[model samples]
Target chain A: MTSYHSINFAQKISKLDELWSPRVISEMNEYQFKAVRIQGDFIWHDHPETDEAFIVLQGRLRIDFRDGAVLIEAGEMFVVPKGVEHKPFAEEEVHLLLIEPRGTLNTGHAGGSRTKPNDLWL
Target chain B: MTSYHSINFAQKISKLDELWSPRVISEMNEYQFKAVRIQGDFIWHDHPETDEAFIVLQGRLRIDFRDGAVLIEAGEMFVVPKGVEHKPFAEEEVHLLLIEPRGTLNTGHAGGSRTKPNDLWL
Candidate 1:
């Protein structure tokens, strides 16, 4: 259930090191799910009008919500629904791909420290 | 651009023949993009609330819109925005996968001729 055909999750991790740089895997319409490498702490933010889904390719990632939190590991995924207040943090570098509508803003109500531009292909 | 790592587009086509049956490739959050083998004509319908995306894995598939039509081929993807009128047709067997919210309905405005149940693993 964790392994994907020819999908070398480890290989993808080898390709990048930046916190928010996403490399496109595939495109459906205007939306594309891309892989990224993250480490340490991330800015606190949320998407007011869009729901974002994250799938861990390697390592561990945590989404801190206003009330509770969710821990996602390799082979696991978590969806942050629209308008939820949250922040993402990682103890070590984690590789993940995010799926969401095109032109969605990375930061929702809290954008000062966490907003990221879209369509940066690795 | 056309091929995915360890991803077998051709092998998936050989596994099934029925229309609208989608097989999971990967999941992000609660949503998943699955590969499905489709053919002939589909029912006219629309998603009133959610936008649907289709990526042509093999063969040719057409999305009939209210005013015009969009043709998608292998390696190409199309997104049907919410509340749009559309019907899919294929001259031969067409393989594709849908990416959307987990509970999205296949038929938007029109249903009956088509309205597949969710979470059918291939």
Candidate 2:
């Protein structure tokens, strides 16, 4: 097993160049912690079995549900429930820490066009 | 089921007074997010089954393992693996976000004297 030192999220986020691509930073049991930079619109998708947690580290983000939307700013967090379809959008670039089960896809149900296959650790 | 709006971790943490007692802020699937203010020395303990994640939002924290210790600073995180006997100590007051299952107790095996039975939601 790989032992870990304490990790700095800000320092790791600074190293990322691609938007919407999530890099695994740490893991707890079966779950993985990911950091992602996103802007504009992301495809509408939902995980059928696992609930996804989104924590806004910097900037602003919006998760639009079918009937309404929730806006999350820095220092806030929101959990998108399982089987609930939602689209994530950011007018400006937003940094996010995502929590989900290991091997879970970013695009969820909708893939192909925007599916990012590679998962990196920082 | 209770639907959640985006939550601010900073604002919620600001309202805490008692140190070492954890408050539940959010939940995703079977897991829950908790905010805890800790200082000085904590009891040595270990969860027999679950892994615990510690994310330092402010100040500094150190987790002393049997062999070595991990020093976590602001914007940093560390995961204490299952069944590892560890002691958490912070020279200064540290703001922490802890992730675990819904009914996890702060003191895993060692309790009684330093056990906090009440769990609050902020």
Candidate 3:
């Protein structure tokens, strides 16, 4: 029988031990849904190939752009357009659901030590 | 300056007066994130061209397939594969976030009176 399980955001997020590291939870077409826990500031980066969506599951998220910043609280979301430089910061540990295409990196084109391997399932 | 506003799911869902009708909130690439309020049973349909993802923001949801059913509660999500017939039912009113490609109809190929206009923004 095909698995009819649902992906619980909080449940999957609880299993994530590393901050800034997102693990794939599900996929739709070529897009992927990832669960991640983040706190503090992230590196500035830009996905030249695809847009990135951030859905806040718990706590607040702030994405700083070149011109302004967006504050995303629980039950809120923001989408960063492709080729826009952004740096994400969280005051507290924030659980997030990131939706983007497969092979999209956490650090975008700003490859650094913070870059985690893609397609790591939770 | 570019708009730096975030989309609040609950705030958007509250503006919806019609049940089972989804309104576009934001877009990431070719995909759109829609907020909707739903209750009762939906028509059995399947998207042949792409998959559909449903993220429950409040209440419980049950998606019935030919062989099995998947129950998704608040903070949970499920992606119905392309060409898989499924019907969604909710015991009470449910706040939902739907992610699908642009121009996707709520009623898929089983279009009928239940098919609402696509791309209606909130």
Candidate 4:
């Protein structure tokens, strides 16, 4: 018998201790759904290979692009186009549901100490 | 000048007048994020090509399988594995955010009256 379970965003997010580190909660084919807690500012980077999605679960999130910025609050979402340089910022701690292809990095090609390991499942 | 905008689930869902008819709100790579309002029972179908994700935006949702069912509430999500036969039922009107690859049909291979048209954008 297959055990069916629902993935709760808040419950999964509660287990995330570090900021900006996304932990995989589920997968759809080659794509992955990750839960992350983020605050402060993130480095500007571009996913040259794929687009990235951000679903704000709590608090507000701001994604700054080269030309403009988008503010996403709870119950809101935004998609950053591939190859577009952008940075994420939050005034307070925010819970997010990120959807992207497997093996995609948080910092894209701008690898640094802030880059979290990929495929870290929760 | 580039225009940056956030996709609000409530705002987008407000435009969806038909039940079970998913309208595209955003796209990440080849995957499309659709907003749908549904109530009552759905048909049993399976997507042989890709998995389907359902994020409950409002009300409770239950996906019944051959053996068991998964109950998902507001602020929760569930991913139905590929090729798994399932049906969705809601006692009350429920709003959902569906994530799937482009051109994925709601009824999968179950070509009946319930099969909604693909790529309907809002």
Higher-ranked by TM-score: 2 or 4: 4
- Point to the candidate with the largest DockQ: 4
Q: Could you give candidate 2's per-residue lDDT for residues B1-122 as a string of tens digits?
A: 33448988888889888899999998888899999899999989999889999989889999998888999998889999999999999999999999998778899977777887645687
Question: What DockQ, on C-alphas, does every prediction get?
Answer: 0.06, 0.57, 0.75, 0.80
Better of 2 and 4 by DockQ: 4
Q: Which should have the higher DockQ, number 1 or number 4?
A: 4
RMSD of 4: 1.0
Q: What is the TM-score of each candidate against the true structure?
A: 0.53, 0.94, 0.97, 0.98
TM-score between candidate 3 chain A and the true chain A:
0.97
Fnat values, one per model, are 0.05, 0.71, 0.86, 0.90
The window of 10 residues in a row where model 3 chain A has the poorest summed lDDT is A1-10
Task: Name the runs in model 3 displaced over 4 angstroms.
Answer: A1-3, B1-3
- What lDDT tens digits, residue by residue, belong to model 4 across residues A1-122? 56788999999999988899999999999999999999999999999999999999999999999898999999999998899999999999999999999999999999999998999999
Instruction: Give the C-alpha miss distance for residue B57 in model 4, angstroms.
Output: 0.5
In candidate 3, what are the lDDT values of residues A14-102, reduced to their tens digit? 89998999999999999999999999999999999999999999999999999989999999999999999999999998999999999
Interface RMSD over true interface Cα atoms for each candidate: 16.2, 4.1, 1.7, 1.4
Where is the poorest 10-residue window by lDDT in model 1 chain B?
B1-10
Q: Candidate 3, residues B25-111: lDDT per residue as tens digits?
A: 999999999999999999999999999999999999999998899999999999999999999999999999999999999999999
The lDDT of model 1 is: 0.68
Tens-place lDDT per residue, model 4, B8-42, is: 99999999889999999999988999999999999
Cα DockQ of the candidate 1 complex: 0.06
